[model samples]
Target: MLPPDLPPLPALTRAEAELIDCYLEVVDLLGRINPARTEHTYGGLRAAQALVGRAAALRDALAVMHRRGESEVHAPTLARALRVLDGERRAGRLALPPSPGG
Candidate 1:
């Protein structure tokens, strides 16, 4: 049985899938590190934690943007892609290129 007032589910894009994968990886890492109780000792762990938080926030933001029915297709798509890439970068799965000035 379905709720009559509920809207249909939106189709997730490939970018969204990648974002989800990155998120899952971060979650797994967090789980592994949590028991060690060594987050304070390692800079990478703390950074990873921050990345998790940021990724979560980005996910929430994407959902809200999706629900708002914004007519600008490009905005939503770009936002979606960026969020995924950001998560990947944070997770150390993707290395960011050096800045031009460097």
Candidate 2:
């Protein structure tokens, strides 16, 4: 459960919500597949396999928004939603860890 002190999620249209959900799903999968972070290839392979569908879903979500004339992304609002959803930490997994000796 999210902490009570976290800000409320911004209101979003159905397509927008779907887009964000799909985007995060892809992010999570990529994080799992990060070679710098993963200890085994099998798990990363599974996540990599799953990433294809998630990427398609993310594409479809954007297409839906485009068809609905929501051409512009409201970055500030979406950033707030991402912050509330722990996107920073999730995305951080994509980065390589600091060098052990440096």
Would you estimate the TM-scores of all the predictions?
0.34, 0.93
lDDT of 1 by residue, 5-71 (tens): 5433245654454445555555545544553334354755665667777677557655654766633
The lDDT values for all models are 0.53, 0.94
lDDT of 1: 0.53
Clashes of 2: 0
Which pairs, if any, clash in model 2? none
lDDT winner among the candidates? 2
- lDDT (C-alpha) at residue 61 in model 2: 97
Number of the top TM-score candidate = 2
Per-residue lDDT tens digits of candidate 2, residues 1-102? 965798889999999899889989999999999989999999999999999999999999999999999999999999988888999999899899999999
Clashes per model (N, Cα, C within 3 A): 0, 0
TM-score of 1: 0.34
Residue 95 of model 1 has an lDDT of 36
